[model samples]
Target: MAGHRNIGSAQSQSFSKAERLNSKKLMDELFNKGSSFVLYPFRVYWMKHEQPVPSKVQVLISVPKKNFPLAVDRNRIKRLMREAYRKNKFLIIDSMNGNEKNLAVAFLFTGKNLSPQNLTPNPSLKQRGMATQKKSSVKNLPQYKLVEEKMIEALNQLSKNSLK
Candidate 1:
């Protein structure tokens, strides 16, 4: 069973510690000097480093405490962001691999908590004259699909920018 395991598959999708941007000095430099662009839910900041590094790209994911007051909410958003990046990071990484410069990137969550707008009431409920109370719904939570889509787009955009 062990011998049959697909090592390439696991390694391709792995988000190792080396990929995380954790240095305070580097973080500050990235935020202060990096160029940025808004892609709806995320504001991406990226800078190319002249120095050589083992990892082609380092990423930092942030969910603002002000937008997500609860620790659980912030953590969930961050998790989603990280997962999205982990899955689609090859869009940027593969492009950067041959380049001499290393990249530092940060993905900041800019959108508010997602909640479905009840613009039109259900016809059946309206006809029955039942009150539509706003209860906590799964629709209000962040979605992986949306996050992954945005992450893919952001990585593509970053790769394009890096080429120039």
Candidate 2:
């Protein structure tokens, strides 16, 4: 992690336990005192940690039980969300390191469950001439990509307003 990172590459990506936010007290405070924003499928909530650390960030990802009644459905969604974050977090980590702050964030999946139609590539993707015809990994669905894009956008916005 000390050296340069390759953007958009999944080879070295990881979401280790150290980077997971699990404190009930911290989570409670984040909801009570943190700022929040809706990034479509996800509702993001974040707050700066009192003691800043070099790691830069710790995050919690959740899929609501209401939307996904079955445990398997919720687990699948959470897995995809976590994978997307693991691949996309370098953008935020570098920016946050520059600002020297530790941030705790929660991403709650709020969108309705993906129906059969939703699993198919978007019409806009087809219109844009993206290759939707070829078989792709089940993990490469458009919704998950959208989640990554929205997360990056939120991280950029957060970097601009980071604790100074």
What is candidate 1's lDDT per residue for 69-140, written digit by digit as tens? 667667877998999998788778778868888999999998875545412223664556553544312214
lDDT for model 1: 0.79
Per-residue lDDT value at 130 in model 1: 50
Poorest 10 consecutive residues by lDDT, candidate 1: 131-140
All candidates' TM-scores?
A: 0.78, 0.71
Best by TM-score: 1
Q: Please list the C-alpha lDDT of all candidates, in the order they appear.
A: 0.79, 0.71
Q: What's model 2's overall lDDT?
A: 0.71
Off by over 4 Å in 1: 1-11, 115-139
Worst 10 residues of 2 by lDDT: 133-142
- Compare the candidates by lDDT and give the number of the best one: 1
